[model samples]
Target: MSGNRAAIRYAKAILQEANEANAGDIVFDDMRSVQATIRGSKELRVMLKSPVIKAEDKRQALLSIFGDQSKYTHSLINVLVGNKRIDMLSGVTESYISLYNEAKGIKEAIVTTAVALSSELEVQVLEKVKEITGSTNVTLKNDVDASIIGGFILRVGDLQYNASIANKLGNIKREFSKSL
Candidate 1:
């Protein structure tokens, strides 16, 4: 939507600014922290999206949470608040991470399994993702979801390979219903 497009625009602008200052990596770290902090706190999320709160208060809250950011990051806060788009902070951070990874030529693969992946399994998954993406710079994130029961789901960019037991069971149930 428009909001996402705007977030991407803001992310691109900030990335360019950071790169010009040779602080892209530092800003990338700041964005990751911002994303994690925003994702972890419901109150923060609510405040960002709340129209009842004044822009100054929201800026103060964000500054308090991420006061140690780089100059570019602090400038970003001011710009977003000035534009009255502080509510898009989370989206902006998420877009910034995606843009940063793409700029760095790093592909992120997410693997969801019933339990945490062992070291060997993680290595194997990493190798598989590298092969699939044809990129040596690949990062793997392992997520544990008990509902999957067994097997794993691998996601790289827009590609998703769902081999979870839950999916198989659902397919089987669909087939039975179709036959009847």
Candidate 2:
């Protein structure tokens, strides 16, 4: 939890700098790339979190991996390395993206279903999420979870609606046990 808070602080500072330089969009894309790169590579994640790796080494590795990034991104890397908080890079990127989206009045929604949603269904879900959040700009992410069996789970910010078949079955089982 404390780590997350620290990431948020770093992200806000970077966002402010990027906005002041009129490079918020560029920095936003760079952060997305950073998040995706770190998320995609297991070795990179391990290296970032490894106590044995020197902070300077980690900084150099990141710089080479993400060459040609915006000046703000390079500064963020330098700051994190100096503070010995490079391991929080992924968290910071995520927080930055979330903050950017929020500032742009864009909301992100996640829907977990047993199967991939069709284009028509995705459009419907986007409309529903927009209506619920009262935001015209909404991004929907679909996650497939077979364990749900059927139905879907929708999450928008702090609000979650679980309409999964597994949840209903669990509730029924609990009621049956109480009656017995």
Which prediction has the highest lDDT against the true structure? 2
Candidates' TM-scores? 0.86, 0.84
TM-score of 1: 0.86
Q: Candidate 1 — what's its lDDT?
A: 0.91
Report the C-alpha lDDT of model 2 over 26-89, residue by residue, as the tens digit. 9999998998899879999999999999999999999999878987899999999999999999
- Best prediction by TM-score: 1
Q: Which residue window of length 10 is worst by lDDT in model 2? A: 1-10
**Per-residue alpha-carbon lDDT of candidate 1 for residues 1-180, written as tens digits (9 for 90 to 100):** 113999999999999999998999999999988988887799999999999999999888888888998888888998999999999998998889888888898998889999999999899989988988899999887889999999999988888899999999999999999999
